[model samples]
Target: MLSRSTGRTRHVLTISTLGLTVALALSAALGGPAAQGRAPAAADAGWSSASPFAAAGSELSGTVTVPARRGRDTVVKLWLSNARLTSVPDACRSTVTVRERASSVSADGRALTCLVRSTGSRRTISLDALVDGEPGQQVDVTVMVDGRATPLGARLVTPGVPVPQPDLRLLSSPDFLNADVGDLVRGPGFWRPGRTANSTNADYRRALDTILDDWRAERPESVLVAGDLVEGWWGTEVDRSGNFGPDRTLAQRKAALRRAAATYYPQWKERFAERGLEVHAAMGDHEFGDNPWRAEKRRLAPLFEKEFTKRFGRRADGSPRYADRPRGSKHELSAYAWRPRPDVQVLTLNVFDATAGGMRIRLDRPQLRWVERVLREARQDGVRWVVAQGHTPIVGPVRSHGSSKLTYEGGAHSPLWRLFKRYGVDLYLSGEVHDVTAVHRDGILQVSHGGLFAFGLTNYLLVDVYEDRMELDLRDYATHWRDAPDGTRLWETRPQGMPKHLQVSPTPFTIGTAVVDGEGHLLDRSGILEQYTG
Candidate 1:
């Protein structure tokens, strides 16, 4: 039951009862430094086109078009309905191929990599190609599937335009428990004996793969994850004890955390790398043990945070993982900032500060000072957009489901938000709510979204950053799940066990969309987010 309101008519197609598809026709404008104010020639009218591909005995039918067009690279995206693939095949194995007809145009030297993934009954194909031609020249592109040629689309190269900067397509989702107990159970045999095989079911994997495939099709420059990358019970043995007895020494507990980190971190990162994605992740409460931080759990928080830093905050040589971090700060690795584009700065905050008082869901003094410095520097550097992400929301009365409902210590009037208001940070992204809520205050927009994937409430946000404006699209997919059997423990923290099986709808449609100008002004808003704009 995923839906959207775009303020314009949209066509929804139900493909073979597998999923829903929304057809959108958008025009492409000339981009790049030189093309800043130049009008796109009429020949670019078909820079993007969605044409149906129906072949005999073909299980796939949907739109094929060039969704992204950079200076010399064009990304063609193919959406197929009711198509199921046995495995996620490389782009070379895909039946889809792109051919360009222009004298000066030739393929870029890089090898062509395509990602073909099947989720539920839907399938997605993404192909990247270098289309080199003179500016203003019309390049006719055709997509061939199984040797059947279809007029996929055409685009015009702008004259005198310098090589375009990398496209600014960013995809984000939080509370993504990419790990399954089944994955851990298959690893180093650390669990207690006689444990059943609790790996993720095939259906769940398929749904996840499909979602990843869609992300690939979008051709994002980077992916941001707010936190909860795994169902981390790490050092604790609440559900299934390790080979050692339940009452272990401090050293034994530390060793357990290392083993768990070694097993899960690589796999979690591989999911993004294999799809050719660059990800910037923040640490969630799950990284240091789930919420309700009792005395014993609090004692192990530092150990857990160390392991997390070793994996995410540092590189192989023990240097910091992120180049742009809060210098001289204690939480430098956990809290960092980077500029994906010259005009945009993105910062990831580690809000879980394990103080002597308890686990305080607030940025410590060092990190808070660092945040203000970064924002001040961004303003001085003329950065157009500043987006900050943490694990929990700072504004409230938000919805929650299957979560601890942890918010920042002081809500909207907190020091963290006060700094944001002073510096004019455009957006704040957070998760841990297991639901979606949008709040706008003091010229800043806070979006709390992302769901427990196992529970079938998952969603993702796509931000398209342009020269003068940014578009945010919040999309949700329908999912179905049933109760898992007893002893199905994904981790020790969750009282409710993981779902036995989960299936996601093939179609993921937009639930909300918004537009903002360079000055942090809300230019337009629609769908579910419209009500929150005031």
Candidate 2:
């Protein structure tokens, strides 16, 4: 029987750049005839160009005149342009105008910006304004061509607080278990004996395509990858004449791993570059190896440093290789923070590159020190949102104890968790166990979605962050899993026994959950669930 969630579900399809172009053109054409009118005297002033002009394909550009400060009636034109796209097509001319209206105030009160676009022939177009306003401020905008009477109106208004970000979509299936079947020579992990339908996997290729499509559609400022790109273990191989790896050189194994990575990773890389999306990845266990104990990590760290720096690094210099984060940086691994927009700060951590292992848990003192300093500086800088992502999760359900659960600070609980509590980390993103889970401790949120290469898996998660809330969406590939007991569908039903600060809400054909709290306690639940075929 098909899962109930798959019966009537809404899938977030990947819409390409071409799709956006069509939408823009259609919207402008449909609105042109309805807006046929002209404004007063400003028409006689002759044609005047807007202050800022966007290059082609730029999603936003244009100018409007507004009072310099609150309470002033005089308005001067302030033009702003975004140089992102190559050029704006002539077809976009009809949808332009000047904007005037009080919109939402920024975290810091500043000049209000409204949404306005260009219209055909009428250079002096009035756009809608939705920025915040202190009393007594006003501006005048005359969007006019050389001689034609341009239509003008102040329709822009402050946008309502954006809804919490939506959850990412995930698609899953029984067939996902077969993902690595024919690619025995690939993947850095040993293969287990199981039916193709029993393996856990994700449709990475499809997900990559969807992400690119979404980026073109939304034009997000930056994309963040939490970690875990490779399996990090020897790939499944046919046992030949009882031969084992005691004789195989590490160098030979490394070479084989690289070949597999090269074969499987090209498509993902091309998709990222083509979209012009700024891509950031946090090194995961798979990128190096699974169960990377502290000692093993110490040894593997140099090897990976060489591999990435010499092989897969990218920078503004157009070099396809890794560059040191900075001179004299103590982070022997690639861990740093970046801000794509003024409102958001992303901190990526290479948690695996420290001194600890299955028999011992230790946070390399230097790395720990660096983390504290970075967090302190970021908070002091008045950064509103901080998102931390890495490969190993500080807390989650794991099956066999290997590395993360082994030892800790002075043989106590892992130090990473304590750090999270102390620094007020907002969200934690990780992948290791091939499962989807949302665990919240106090107000801190940890969203985990791994299992991309289980087999015939087709699933990915969607996350959305809104001003007042955060939303999570888990999408399955072709079908949904249903409750077998009563054959009843589950949708948007809150989970049971959640702490006051933590909450889970299920949605139609999907599981939508939100943990509401500015601060709360997150208990540790470290046992992995037994595998079952339902």
- Residue by residue across 108-201, what tens digits does model 1's lDDT show? 1112123223232334432222223455454333332222222322334343323233248788898886344346554553664465444455
Best by TM-score: 1
The alpha-carbon deviation from the true structure for residue 335 of candidate 2, after best TM-score superposition, in angstroms, is: 1.3
Cα lDDT, all candidates: 0.61, 0.35
| Candidates' RMSD to native | 14.0, 19.3
RMSD from true fold, candidate 2: 19.3
Model 2: per-residue Cα lDDT over 1-534, one tens digit each: 001111121111111121111111111011111114643222111112222121121122233322122322221122111111111111122111111221111111122222223222222223222222222222122232222222222212222222122222112111111122123333343333331111112333343354346444544445556555544342212211111122144455445445444433443445567877656666555455445344534555455544543323554364642332322443443666665444345666665434444422233556666667767666788755556776555554432211243212331145666666676777776655445455655356665544443221233333344333333334332222223254422110011110111111111112222322234432211111111122
What is the Å distance of residue 401 in model 2 from its true position? 14
TM-score of 1: 0.67
| Model 2 backbone overlap count | 101
- The runs of at least 3 residues in candidate 1 whose Cα sits more than 4 Å from the true structure, single-residue gaps closed, are 1-167, 178-182, 243-247, 484-495, 532-534
**lDDT of model 1 at residue 322?**
85
Best by lDDT: 1
